[model samples]
Target: MQQHNDTIDSAASADEPDQIHEPRLWRDKGWTARVIKNEDGEGWAVEMIRDGSAEPALVGPWTMGRNKVDPKPLDATAHQTLVKTASEVIRRHEQQLHAQLNKEVSIDFGDDVVSVRLTITPDEFEPFGTLIALNPLGDVLATTNVRPDFRLTRESAGRWAADGFGKIR
Candidate 1:
């Protein structure tokens, strides 16, 4: 029993993380890229994220090898090159997003449709997580911190659909 426990602990704290068919990050601080393949095999895409970005800073389609086939799986040698290419892609995307969201969206909410943008601000100080979402017109629709585990997008959409605020099902 003691030996088995030790082995489990060592494996849990292993220096390397095992990733197969799933993207893995070599390091957290520097540039990181995840290779994702289309389910239909139409094409491949690389989601590149850099330091200080909340989400993937850049995303673009990937090319195939000369044989007109998918490039080989990700490995040490290929990973090194990917880092360089992905970084440049992100540098370009950052410039684009910066130019896109120049100002807040103009909301036009009607009786049948509610056109609003919810900006969720999370409070991490308290024990129970708290998040406040404000609409583009600066309206507070709902406020809740009761449940720690909650999804904003799905829940909000479902509620709107159920309440007949969204398109009828």
Candidate 2:
């Protein structure tokens, strides 16, 4: 916990809006990159931290220094690269979460077509989803709880619509 707090503090210090320094592996705006010895003591690892975050956003192997034992020193280019990589990692994770939590499909509803959405709420204790049917005007026609892993496939949506948007068996 102290290590986490220290990391957050380091990130916050580096992220001060007015501060600017030559690129280095240590810290950048709202982010910090630090290299540490691996647990096994056989290799080095780098940790990327975001300001105000109690956990590292990314962690990966680090290159050996000239001593062939110590970790390489952080530099401007390496810091920038690590920041970009960490940002991309965050972006991809968010995209994946969005994809898993929200899904929609169009289906024929009698004379008109409507849309159905399955939005999962991933709770560690009680995972669930809300299967919602929307009319042409975007008004919700129905809503019901479903398994957290429910998928909004075309066949399932069509069947649900046909069944008056109750259960998507």
Candidate 3:
């Protein structure tokens, strides 16, 4: 009987919206900072969670409260710091992914040098890549559909250019 009553109480609470301890420190749009108790029983830890994201974008140590016994409350200065750090983390991740998906190589074709690029477009339904050739003046010469994992190498680019931008064997 006790277990059944407890389950009913939890189910009722689950229907209610999330109740934050301090409403002023959190925002519905953009990113929000929350100060939580550390599991190590030491100090506090801050988590910066972006709106619509399931997990926190960044989490790190936080300062202690004035009495040095409890976790410090969230403040404007601390929230700003967390937002800056989380933004940098997201920026670096985007740059690394772009570098991995986009590749470029230069190959000598007789007297002129040609630039070959392989760009991968990752889509949930159908992922594909585009193999493009550009002249010295950065003008597109040819384009072809390629495998998403295509690699642009000097030998491969040379063969593609020599064959007039046909499918690579």
User: What TM-score does prediction 3 earn?
Assistant: 0.75
- Candidate number that wins on TM-score, 1 or 2: 2
| Runs off by more than 4 Å, candidate 1 | 1-29, 39-41, 63-71, 90-169
Candidate 2 structure quality by residue, lDDT tens digits, 40-147: 668899888887788888899999888897778888688889889988999999999898789999888888788888889889999999988889999999988898
Model 3 C-alpha lDDT per residue in residues 41-134, reported as the tens digit of each score: 7777788888788898887887787899777776656666777899899899899999988999999988889999999999888898899999
Which candidate leads in lDDT? 2
Which candidate comes out best when scored by TM-score?
Answer: 3
lDDT (C-alpha) at residue 28 in model 3 = 26
Q: Can you give the lDDT of residue 112 in candidate 1?
A: 32
Instruction: Tell me the deviation in Å of residue 146 in model 2.
Output: 2.0
Q: Candidate 1, residues 101-153: lDDT per residue as tens digits? A: 22122223343333323333334664342333345454655333433333335
TM-score pick, better of 2 and 3: 3
lDDT of 2 at 92: 95
Off by over 4 Å in 3: 1-25, 39-43, 66-69
TM-score: model 1 vs. ground truth = 0.31
Q: Give the clashing residue pairs of candidate 3, or none.
A: none
